[model samples]
Target: MSVHEEISKKTNKTWGIIQTYRKLDEKREAEIEKVILQCQNNEAFSVDQINKVTEEINSFAAINHLPSRKFVTKQMVEEAAQN
Candidate 1:
């Protein structure tokens, strides 16, 4: 697959895993600060730690590939309106 597609797929997969095991705190916006994992267990992972693990999937891959904001276009808006 293309790099863009690969990145998107890899990033999304990693994000999904993160969502299942951990989540960014209220102040994590725009910053790879801390992601609390297993809140009841007091577990957490930092950006660096996450990157280290994600790198196992791809040498150049990192959890940071996740999108910070949704991209929307006129066509997309129209498509959503149709739906």
Candidate 2:
């Protein structure tokens, strides 16, 4: 391939990464909301429950190579659910 073609290919790849990052960020926020709602309806709101949800999200992020949202504690869930 020509130098110009190679540069264009890399530019497209960079753009794809940016778009994927944006989409993943939005998805992560939605996932957090879903987790909070699940906890709100559950019988008990505990640290373990929060940790389980956090781990699930983090695992998903890991697979996607996105930064994990650490420290999703029970208190954060409780406060977010109220809003």
Candidate 3:
């Protein structure tokens, strides 16, 4: 597979696993959705911001050899929230 295809497969597989375990907590989901919508409306989610976040997450996973959900860190979440 190509490098792009490999990354895409990995990402999709990871998200699939995450989705299986995710509990649909309505309130939290709604809050997250609201924040995402606000960011979208404000054009706060820029391409560089996305790339930085993705790089950080990928680095964390590579350094730790962690599974997808475990790749998420408090620091990562905080950085994303601030952006």
Candidate 4:
């Protein structure tokens, strides 16, 4: 597959996984977050832990298509507000 196609496939997979997680009860989401936090707090992360974190982070990131608000300038916000 081409690079673009490969990336699209991976993104779709991540999005599907995230949607599955969302469909679960909220408690499960909280539990998963707790586990993620625990894994992250370890001094050294295992390869599996790293991979899981990376996947979840990427999946969460895929939820948004817009650029980060951190990059928004005061002028940009003012202009937007004026509209």
Candidate 5:
């Protein structure tokens, strides 16, 4: 899968886990923070340093916010236009 697809899948799964936990709230807690912790523990994502960093950055802002847009260079766009 592409990076965008993977990010979307992870984002959705994170939301699903958070929602499920919300319904079973026996004790009140920071739901978003809890979900992020659970995601951080997953072996599929935590094994690679780069992946872990990306996951943490995205997960920490998954709720009530969006990831900041990255700057694109003119050369980057021109290169893409050549494809």
Candidate 6:
């Protein structure tokens, strides 16, 4: 399978996992939303930076079946683009 296909499959699986964990209660969903907002509001990451970082991390995770910590660096992006 192509990298894009692999990524799509992994993302679908992950979303399924998330959906399974979602509660029917509004309070539960609100709590989850609060945590998500807190993380997104972190001073270190602007909205654009967060989106970029999340995309790269998810891309790497989906492609490699690894955690975000193992994501390729900016240098790797440059190198890959140059090739």
lDDT of 6: 0.47
Best candidate according to lDDT? 2
Which is the leading candidate under TM-score? 2
- Which pairs clash (backbone N, Cα, C closer than 3 Å) in model 2? none
Instruction: Give the higher-TM-score candidate: 1 or 3.
Output: 3
Candidate 4 lDDT at 59 equals: 56
Q: Which candidate do you rate higher for lDDT, 2 or 5? A: 2
lDDT for model 4 comes to 0.47
List runs of model 2 lying over 4 Å from the truth: 42-68
The true-versus-predicted C-alpha distance at residue 22 of model 3, in Å, is: 15
CA lDDT scores, all candidates in order: 0.41, 0.68, 0.49, 0.47, 0.44, 0.47
Report the backbone clash tally of model 6.
Answer: 0
lDDT for 35 (candidate 5): 37
> Candidate 5: worst 10 consecutive residues by lDDT?
43-52
TM-score of each: 0.27, 0.52, 0.29, 0.31, 0.31, 0.29
lDDT of 2 by residue, 22-74 (tens): 66556656666777877778745445544555566567667757677665676
lDDT by residue (2-82, candidate 3, tens digit) is 999999999998786445334322333444445455554654433343344445445555554644322234344445566
**69 in model 4: Cα distance from truth in Å?**
29
Better of 2 and 6 by lDDT: 2
Question: Across residues 20-60, which tens digit of lDDT does each residue of candidate 4 receive?
Answer: 55543243344444444544554322234334444554455
The reply for model 4, stretches above 4 Å from the true place, is 26-83
* Candidate 5 accuracy as TM-score: 0.31
Q: Which stretch of 10 consecutive residues in model 4 shows the poorest summed lDDT?
A: 65-74
In terms of lDDT, the poorest run of 10 residues in model 6 is 20-29
